[model samples]
Target: MYEKELEAILPRCFEMYDFMAEHVEQLQHLEAMPELKLRMAFQSGILSFEHGLSSLKLIADGFTSSGFALMRPQYESLLCGFWLMYADTEAWFNKLSTAGKVSPDEIKKLETPLIGVMLKDLEKSNAPAHILRQLNDFRGINNSAFNSFTHSGLAALVSNGVGYEPKVIYDSLRNCNAVAAINMQMLSILTGYEEAMEPVRKMHHHFVDCLPIIHG
Candidate 1:
């Protein structure tokens, strides 16, 4: 059954993996002025990739855990939480990606519900209804693992000249990475592919590697 699902998802996963991989590599090339500046510039790309990976992990976990009888008890709720986390993280990344692309005023202007677009795409692709609900639930939860970080939060504020620090963004990006790694390990197990997590991991590393160009 799991293999069957993998067979269905493999094509989409591979495609998304490649798409993300390219961006990650491109992100690595973006470099800033000083060492700290360079690190800061790369941080958002890292966070976006990690958060995306976490989303993929949740989907994988939920699908995998749904198959068993006894394991279902523990894994079901875990899977649910991960699913919500995935949606929330992706929303965060999409928000940052959009915000990062524009001026401070533009960031403010772009603050509508864009994640709804992504959710629609997911629904059109036949993503589970429950997963969609999970995402919606996550949207309500303000207690994010990544967003609460001082550096990341401050950078968000500072970017808009809101008198916030930049260091918060740096810390938040790391927090995103930590969650991604942990989440993907479980996904790898569920998908029965140690390489399941490879694409995203490599994507993050690739982005980090290209920090030089992205900063410019």
Candidate 2:
């Protein structure tokens, strides 16, 4: 059953994987100032995209809950990376604080100068409208669903049965592809890799074409 579903989407998955691998390699060749926040965010996005591919492969192998659990963080890495691209240094430190990478004592010193500012507050002031819209879309469409799996909620348990459903596998692949497309687009913009544009657009169209719609 899993094999059948995997065989059906294998071609599309391979295409997306190849495209992402090529761009990831290309990204390594581009030079950006070491001090630039966008560069770090772009790198993080790339890493997340790679991990997301691994999760998708697990889904193909019938580890559906595990794959779904990985999706939220993958989405976060992309969202945070893109958000940080336009944020200031203070926002950068704030992010680290939010992630608990910074100690409370250290965050205290950092926050002294940035007393009331929060990452959410910076969104409107720093990020572009389109970026904000993308973040909102992810929150609405994927975030909640992904969270249910990540947190071991009822949705995750309900889908952990023995059989593999083709629609389930296809939807998982589509979600992964969508994230890859967004990650590539963000990297291209930040790294000035205009060559990625055509491939990313093609990938996006593939996702749109393959999406399943429910008629009520």
What TM-score fits each model? 0.25, 0.74
Count the clashes in each prediction: 21, 0
- Residues 67-157 of candidate 2 have per-residue lDDT tens digits of 8788877877776676557655665565655756667676655421221132364465656666565556556676566878899987777
lDDT of 1 at 139: 36
Backbone clash total, candidate 2: 0
Task: Tell me the deviation in Å of residue 156 in model 2.
Answer: 1.3
- Go through the candidates in order and give each one's C-alpha lDDT: 0.39, 0.66
**Residue lDDT tens for model 1, 25-67:** 5434533224332233234335434544554454345421111
Query: Where is the poorest 10-residue window by lDDT in model 2?
Result: 110-119
lDDT of 1 at 83: 34
Weakest 10 consecutive residues, lDDT, candidate 1? 64-73
